[model samples]
Target: MIDSGESAVSDSILFVTHSPQRSGAESVMLDLAAECHRRGMSVSVACPVGPLSESFPPWAVHVEIPHLGRDHGRRTRAGAAWGMARSMVVAARTLRAHRGTAIVANSAHTLPALRLAGVRSVAWLVHDHLVSRKTRVFIGAGRPLLHHVVAVSPTTASALDGLVDHVAVGRLGVDIPDDAPTGALPTGPLRAGTLSVLTPWKGVDVFLEAVARLDDATAVVAGEAFPGDVGYAAQLRERAGHPDLAGRVTFPGRVRAADALAQWTVHVSASIAPEAGPLTAMEAMAAGVPVVATDHGNPRNLLADRRGVLVPPGDPVALADAMSSIAADPHGTAAMVRRAYAHVAEHHDRRETVPALLDLLLGTTSSSAPAAPADAVAAPSRGGGGSR
Candidate 1:
């Protein structure tokens, strides 16, 4: 990462997000982008074309183009490449429009084009671990392009194998109010909350299986179905209605991130697959809600002090037991909330993370320096090509 701490102010920033909707990655992008905009730096977010493109704030600029890669099988390989090319053209044009602007590219997927465009002063923000071949390809491709890399946690940074320029383990923050009212809890039984998109990888089925293990717990499932995965959501709904666990589970569709947090006593993150870092968990913690999450990937690092229970992945019995334990102990639940807040205040506060992230954008703070004495390229790394 190039050390640009020498500079005073960043003129503008182009944040590359893969989605316009509210995913974990997009949540970080929006929060930071809004903050930068608040700080009087011109900030804009560019995302692949989608229905949610209209949701960006009116003051900030928005650009949409074909996805760098297709989601699932929406486009062929050549089509994805072409889409990427189109997105690159838009990105380059956007960068040129706001000359001297910093490009904060989110996700490893955009690395290749950021590289091809030769846009100097780029920060690669790693929102999660890349465990798949396609994801690794993107990471390996973009490792060189980064002036710095921002990871959401130390655990996340450690998992990256030192490929990033500067490894800042900045956690995402939530602006939960201290005086906000905790809404009335359901009178029926022990209510559990889940806030994630309905995708197979997110393990909603696994969550349902856990619900099956609970006789009195009612699980409130939030978030929309992923592209081409509505059927899976239906299956979860149907499964929850089975005689075994029918009255114990319900799907209420998507909830506004803030409003959703206000409605739940506990947050559940049941991802069976590797999650880079989930904003859902962070938000839940910030809202002072105890989370019952899987003990893999980033959650283990975030939820340390028994603030929340950590269960092995793909284990419903464990999840059920943990939920029951939490529901049974109100005092323990309050303690969990306090501990979670303290953890966020001590380590994951956005106040600390955002400025460090800005350092990456300004080229002031980075782990790796620029590659050559050139304007565009940064130093090469072990398993990658030019600077992303």
Candidate 2:
């Protein structure tokens, strides 16, 4: 562990982000950077810089490279690979210049270069499942190069069997003001469903299908298209006006970063594919709002038997029923709010998570695995039985 008392910091950590864009991964990195800074570590972030330049910390130095963007297809994939190699070379040179600190490689694209840079201690933070074959290959190449692989969830950790030497599960922390509104009961007919990026995996279409089934409450969707997702977003907007869904749906485009987590009554993370760990659900729980979500990815682990309702993915009937249950019972909503706040307070609180994560990064802990105590239950996927 690097010293952290009332001493001057000799170590620095370089955070490499592939997409400087304000998605969940970037948000997690920002929290980690802020936490590191608070703990007296010299910190900086490097990215293939663009519009996201404004999103960095004022005090920390920013490094820019030409290789990163929001592209995901085959041709762009080859470009990203080449760009990563060049960026890695530059990163290695920079690390040598800085000397004493560790490197926190936050993206799949930056791992190989960090390895080549020969930093004795390098930690790779993995935020999602290596779903595609290409992702698996990228991760596989970086396996031996990383000192530790930090997975955001247990399921994600389980997926990386031979990729990394050590694996740790670090859940994201949710920090909301103590004086923020609490004990909130659903008082209006307006219900909100949010996922900041409109994509197939996020189940935006599935959410709209559920909205078509709801008659009592208005469903507001918050998100916009990324570079290649404009067509999908347009189709969703068009379908929002089906005969059954016409009056109930509202597409609010994109929710601003500052207000994304705070403006909704109920947050819905309607993911069809298993996501790594969804911050929106955690944010909703922190805001004392109940959530209705599909049992895909980390929500099953996060919500368990408290604070939210889980339904089978792509099942509009089940989703509609779950939404109705939340909308019809105001008392239930209040209880869920209490449970949500309590759940996040006990597990996802910054005070608890940040320290644990620091310990892992510093090599003070033997197991990076998340502890599932008796009070905490694991969330399951679509067909898995609910935990009581």
**Alpha-carbon deviation at 109 in model 1, angstroms:** 1.4
**Which stretches in model 2 have alpha-carbon errors above 4 Å?**
1-10, 68-100, 116-120, 177-184, 256-265, 364-388
In the range 196-221, model 1's lDDT, one tens digit per residue, is 88988888888888878877677788
Model 2, poorest ten-residue lDDT window? 379-388
lDDT (Cα, tens digit) per residue for candidate 2, span 1-388 = 1332222224567777666566888777777777678768777787766545577768677876444333555377678666556666776665555335656667776655555665555677778765456566555655554555677777676566554555766676767547544556546664767755887778888878877776766677777777668888888988987787777778777675336555556677788888776777777787777788888677777777666899998887888788777767778777777877777776777666666665555555425335533233324222212111
Estimate the lDDT of model 2: 0.67
Q: Tell me the whole-model lDDT of each prediction, alpha carbons only.
A: 0.67, 0.67
Clashes of 1: 15
